[model samples]
Target: MRAKAFDTKVFKRILEYTKPYQWRFNGVIVFAVSLSVFAALRPYLLKQTVDGYLKTHDAKGLLFYVTIMGIVLLMEVFSQFYFVFWANWLGQDIVKDIRIKLFKHMLSFRMKYYDNAPVGQLVTRSVSDIEAIAKIFSQGLFMITSDLMKMGVVMIFMFYMNWKLTWIVIVAMPVLVFITRIFQRKMQLAFEEVRTQIANMNTFVQERVTGMKIVQLFNREAIEADKFSQINDKHNKAWIKTILYNSIFFPIADIISSLTLGIVVLYGGIKILNGDHFTTFGDLFSYTMFIGMLFNPLRQIADKFNEMQMGMIAANRVFDILDTKDQIQDTGIIEAPIFEGNIQFKRVHFSYIENEEIIKGINLEVKAGQTIAIVGATGAGKSTIINLLNRFYEISSGTICIDGKNINEYSLSSIRKQIAVVLQDVFLFADTILNNITLNNPNISREEVILAAKKIGVHEFIMSLPNGYDYNVKERGVMLSSGQRQLIAFLRAYVSNPSILILDEATSSIDTHSEELIQRATEKITMGRTSIVIAHRLATIVNANKIVVMDKGLIVEEGSHFELLNIEGGFYKNLYYSQFLVENNS
Candidate 1:
C-alpha cells in the first residue's frame, strides 16, 4: 500500500460542504431517532394488552389496541423513507462538488505536476475515488446510523421494562466491542489492500490499452497479458480477504448475540419461575421480542465497521489531491486584462528541476509583431524559450516582462489568453469540428470559423468530410490524419489572433504536399503577430525576419539569412551548408 499522510483537517474541509445543508441533515437524524422510538414502543404495547385488557375481553378495548399499533407502524415507515431519500441526495451532491474542485485544482498546477504524475492514477482520483466518497456517505453512513439509533433506544427501553434481562444483554457488550475493535483494525488493512489492488488493475488496463500500438510494434502482447493477469490475480486475492473478513464478522458476532439470547432467557425464566416478577407468559414473550430487536441493530453496527474503514481509505486518496497547492495561480487582488506583444528577457534563468539549469543569463528583446525563428539540435533548449514566455514554469532567477510589466504580476488567465501555442503533439476534442475550432468561445459565429479555416486552407477540405463541423473528432482526433490534425490546430490558433504565438515543431509531421498548402496559411497567420517558430527544416524558416541558433542553453548566433550565410564558419553556416548541399543534389 502507498504510504498515506492523513490530513487531520479533512473533517474540517468536509464540514464546509455539509454546512449549507445543516437543517436537512438535522431533519434526517430526527427522523432516524423517531423511528427507533416507535419500534421500541411496538412491543411494549403488546405487553399492556395481554397483561391488562385482553383477559377482560372488552369489546371497545380490542378496537383501540389494534388502531394504536397501526399508527406507530405508519410513523416508523415514513421516518425510514425520509432518511434514505435525502441522505443519498446529499451524498451525490457532495460528489459533484468534489469532482469539480479536484479538476479545477489539477488544472491549476504547474506543468511539471502532470509530467511527473501518472495519468492513470489521476484518472482514478477523479472517477473511482470520488465515487467511493459518495457510496460511503450514502448507503454506508445512513445504514450505520439507522442501526445504531435503533439499538441505543431499544436498549434504554429494555432496561426500563426488565432490569434483570437488560443486564444479561449488557454483560455481552464488552465482548462484542472487543471483537469488533479487533476485526475493525485487521479489516482496515485489508480494505486498504483492496483499494491498492484496484488502482493497480486500473493502471494496468490504461497502460496496455493506450500503448496498444507500442505493444504490437514490440511483439509484447504476451508480456502485457501476463502483467495484466498478475494484477487481476492480486485483486482477486485482496477481494477474497475482504470477503472472508466480512463472512466471519457476522457469524462471530452472531454467535455472541446468540449466547446473549440464551443467557437472557435462562436467567429471566428462572426469575419468573421463582416469582421474582410476573408469571404471565405474554410478559416473558414480549420481553424476548424486544431483546431480539435490540440485537438486530447491534449486528448491523458491527457489519458497517468494514464499510467505514474502506471509506476512510478512499477519502484519504481524494484529499491528497486537494492538499497539493497549484504552483501557478491567480490571486484576485487586482488584474490587468489587456496586453501588447512587446517582450524582454532580462538575465532569465530556469530549470524544470533543481539539479541542472537550462537557460543561463539569457537576455533578449523582441519588438511587437516581429517574426523570429529558432533552430537547434534536440535538447538544446529551443522549446524552453516559449515555456518561459507563457509562464508555464516560473523563472528561477531574473525577470520576464511583457509590455514593460513583470509577467508574474498579471493574471494567469490574462497572460495565457493572449498566447496561442501549436505544439508538435496535436490534440482535438471528441466533439464536433465546429466546437473544437471555436473551443470555449461561445460568442464566436460559424461565419468566423469558416473564415478562419479558409484562411488556413482547411475550409474546403473540412466541407469535403461527411459531417463537416458536426463530426466527432473521436478522442484526440485519432480518426484524422496527423497532417490534417496539424492543419486544424494551426487554424484554431490563428483564429484566436493571439498577441504571442509559439509554434513548436508545428509542421514537422506534415507531408510535402500539406506543408506547401500550409505555408501560405502560415504567412497569413503571422502577418502582424509576435510569432516564434521552432523548426527543424531550414528551408521552411528562411523567410523569417530573424534567426537565432542555440547550443547548450545559450544563443550562439543571431542574424538575418544573408549575414549568417556569409560567415561560413559559425554553427549556422555549417548546418545551412549541409542542408544546402542536400537540397541542390536532390
Candidate 2:
C-alpha cells in the first residue's frame, strides 16, 4: 500500500494549475471572508434584539435594530451566493485545463508505456482523480479556511465580552482539536483504500465486459459472477470503513459542542443572578449564541478536513502519471515534404525486452519504386521491421535510412506523413465512411477521397450503401463485414497519397472473392510506389521484385520469387509449398 501522507510536490503542482485563474479564485476568497464576518454578526444582533429592545418595550428602537439586522442578513445572502458560485467556477475551470494538459501529455507517450499500463486505471486517473481535486477547491480549501476564520473572530469577541465565560468555552477546544486530528488520520487511510479498491473493481469490470462474449460462449457466466461479487464486496467494505470513521467522529464533535454550551449557560446565568456588575442578561444571551457559532464551524471544518485529505491523495495519483518519464523525446530537426522511398537497413538489431533481441544484424535495401515481399513464419521479426521503419520502436544497434539519410534525422510526423500502412487487423473509428477515409484532414478534400476510392475500385461498393459515402461504420467498424472494413482501411491509406506503402498480411482473413478484389486493388496502388508486403499467402507476393525469407532473427535467403524457388531446400521454397498444399487441400 502507498503512504497516505500529504505530498508537497503534488500539492504545489495542483496549486500551479490555478495560477491562470488566480484573479477569480482571489475574488472567491474575498467573498468567503465577508461571509464569515456577516455570519458572526447575525447572532450578536439577535442577542441585542432579545435582551435590550424586547425587555424595555421600546417599539421605535426595536424597529431600528430589526431593520439593521435585516440589512446584515441580506448582505450575508449576497456574499454567500457569490462565494459558492465563484468557488465552483474556479474549481471547474482549473480542472478543465488540467484534464486537457494531462490528455495531451498522455498522447505523447511511447507505445511501450501503454503496453504496460491498464486502460481502466488510466481512465480512473483522468476522470475520477481530477474530480476529487475539484472538490478541494470548492468544498475543502475555501470552506475550511472560512470556518477557521469565523472561529478566530468568534473567539476574540467572546474573550473581549467576558473572559471568565470564554475560559469555560475554551476548555472544550483542546478535546475537539485532538479528536479531529485522530479522525483525519484514520479517514485518510480509509479514503485511500477506497480509491484503490474502486480502481481494481473498474479494471475487473472493464476486462470482463469487453470479453463477455467469450465468457458466455464458454458458459462461465455463473463463475464470473461469483468472482465479480468478491471484488464488489471488497469495494463495499472499503467504503463502509470510511462511513464508520465518519460516524464515530461527527457525534463526538457534537457531544463536545453540547458540553461547552451547557458550561457557558450554567456559569453565565449564576453570575447574572448574583448581580455581578459586569454581567448583563444581553451579554449572557450573546455568549450562548457566540459559543454555538464557534463550535458549529469547527464541526464543519472537521468534515472539510476529510475532503482535503481525499483531494490530496487524488492529486498524488494524478501527478504520478504526469511524472512518468517513459516518453519518446522527438529531437529530429529535418523536415521531409516528400521522401524518394529509398529504404536501407544495415545490421539493425532490436529487442522489445532487454537482452532478448528479436531482430539481429539484418541488412536489406530497396530502390525508390520497388515492391519487396517478406515471407517468414511467425516470430521471425517481419512486423518488427515495419515497426522500426515507422520509428514506433527504436533500433538497438546499426542504422535504418530513407533517401540516404538516417530516418531519425527527419521529424517523426514528417516521416510518418509520407508512409501509410494497412494491417491485417484493420481498425476504423465509429464515423461516416467519408470522415473515416479523410480522417478530418483539412487538406484532403471530399473530391480527393472520392477519386482515391474509385481508383481503388471501392467507390461503387460505398455508393451502394443506404447513405452512400456518408454511411456510419459503428464502433470498431463492427457494423461492416471484415472485408468491408479492410476496403475502408485501404481507401483511408490511399487518400493520404503516401510515397511508401506497407501491407502486413492484408489479404490473410478475407474470402476468395474479397481477396481477388483486394489483390487487384493492391497491384494498382503499389504500381509506382515503394511497397513492403508481409505475406502469409504466397500467391499475393509472387510478382514482387525481390523476396526475402527470414527465420529466427536473420534473413535466410533473398532473391526474386522464382530465383528463390531454384535454391535447394530453401526456407522460402518450403513455406510457399506448405501454404500451396493447404490451399489445394481446402
Candidate 3:
C-alpha cells in the first residue's frame, strides 16, 4: 500500500507516549521558541550596529551592541543544546517503552499467531521499525517545529525592516513549496518500499542463518547465496530511490533559495542606491541575513519533513502489531495453584484455520495420576490434543476441564504453571545448563535444579561436560548432542514439578543409552502425576494405564496395550505389528 505523506492518527498516537514526559516535552518547546527569538534578534542587533553605530562612527556604541549580540548568541547556544539533548532523550525513552510493550504483547499472543508469522519480520518491527519511530521525536517533530518557528520570526523581522523587499523574497516561496510537496509524496512512497525491502532481506537472512546447518548439509550454499544476493539487490535499489530523490530535490531547493537571495540583494541594493527614505543600507544588510535565516530552515524543513514522514510510516506499521486483538484472553478469575490433574475434553473441536478442522469432536478423559498414551501416524492430530489441553490454542467448540472445572475458569498463568511439556524438538537458550533448566526463574534455586538432575540420573552426565551445571549450551543447544538436549529438557520439565506432565515423542529420535536414561527418568517423574505421552514408538506405552489409537483426527481405538493387541485386525493391532515388524527387520 502507498503510505500517506502525513498520518494524523498515527502522529497523535505517537504524541500519547509523551504524556509521561510532559515536563521534558514542554522544555523542548520552550527552548525552540527561545532559540527562534534569539536567532531573529541577532540580525536585528547587527542592523542596529551598522545603521546607528557604524554609520555615525560611534566606536563605544559599536562595542556595546557587539557585546549585547554576544550575550544573545550565548543564550541561543544554550537553548539549542538543551533542545537537542532533551528531544533525543525523550525519543529514546519513548522507543524503549514501545519496544517493551510490543514484546510483552507478542508474548501474550496465541500459538496460531506465531505459526504463520515470520520471525525476522517480527524482529524488524520490534527493533528496526521502533528505532525509526524514535526519529519522530529526535529529528522529526521537534526539529520541524523549531525550524518553522525560526522561519516565522525571521519573516516578521524582514517585513518590519522593509515590506517591499520582503514581498520579493516571498515570491520565490510558492515555487519551493510546490516542489517540496511533490518531493514529499514521492519520497514517502520510496521510503515505504525501502522499509519493505529491508524487512524482506531481514527475513531471508534470519531464516538462512538459523537453518545454516541444513543449507550446508544439502549443498545449498551457492543456491542460497544467489537468493540472498537478489534480496540484497532489491534492498539496495529501494535505498537508491530515496537517495535519488534527495539528490534531485535538495539541489532544486538550494537553487530556488539562491535565486531568491539574488533577487533580494538586487532589489534592496537598487532601492538604497536610488536614495529611497523607506529603505536604508542597514535594511539591505539585515534583509540578506534574514533571507539566509528564512531559506535555510525552509530547505531543512523538507529534509525534516521526510524524517517525520518515515517515522509516521513506521509508527503505522508498529501500531498495526500493537492494535492486534489476537492475544489469548487472560480474563479467567480462578487461580488454582495446584491442579488435581483430572483432565477431560468434552466434544472438543478445533482448527487452526476456519472450517478446516484438525481435531474433530474429540472426547477423552484421563483421571488423576493416570498415565495415558496416544499413538498415531503423522497428521493424525495427536500433538493437537496436547496443544488443546495446554490452551496454547483455543478450541473452536468444546469444553476442557481440569479437576471437573472448565479449564477456561482458571487463570492462564496458574493453569500453565501446573503443567509441563517436553517436546520432540527440544529448545534451549544459550546459557549455563542450570539456567536453562530453571529458565532463570529466581524462585528455582541452583540447589533445586541440581537436586532434580540427580533424581533424574543425568547429574553425572552433566558433570562430565566442561563445567558441569555451569556449561553453556550454545544457541538451541547446538553444543550438545540431540540425546543430551532431550535429557536437559526432561530435567527442565522435572524441575517444574508440574501436576500434569506431557512428553510429545520425547524419545523417538534419541540413541539407545539416552533413551534408556529418559525412559527411567520418565517413569520416576510420572509416578504421582497425571501424564499424557504421545509417542510413535508403541513399545514405550505398553505399560500405560490406557492406550489411545487415533487416525484422521478421530479415536479409532482405546484400551490397554494388551487389550488393543488382542482385537483382530483392529487399527491399534495393525499399527503395533507394523512397528514391531519394522523394528525386528532393522
How well is each residue in 30-55 modelled by candidate 2, as lDDT tens digits?
Answer: 99889988887877787678777888
lDDT of each: 0.79, 0.87, 0.92
lDDT rank, highest first? Answer: 3, 2, 1
**Considering lDDT, which of the candidate structures 1 and 2 is the better prediction for this target?**
2
What lDDT does candidate 2 reach at residue 112?
81
lDDT (C-alpha) at residue 70 in model 2: 93
Q: How would you order the candidates by TM-score, starting with the best?
A: 3, 2, 1
Clashes of each: 0, 0, 0
Error of 3 at 521 (Å): 1.1
Worst 10 residues of 2 by lDDT: 1-10
**Alpha-carbon RMSD, each predicted model:** 2.6, 1.7, 1.4
Candidate 3, residues 496-555: lDDT per residue as tens digits? Answer: 989999999999999999999999999988999999999999998999999988898888
Please estimate how well model 1 matches the true structure, expressed as its whole-model Cα lDDT: 0.79
lDDT at 568 for candidate 2?
86
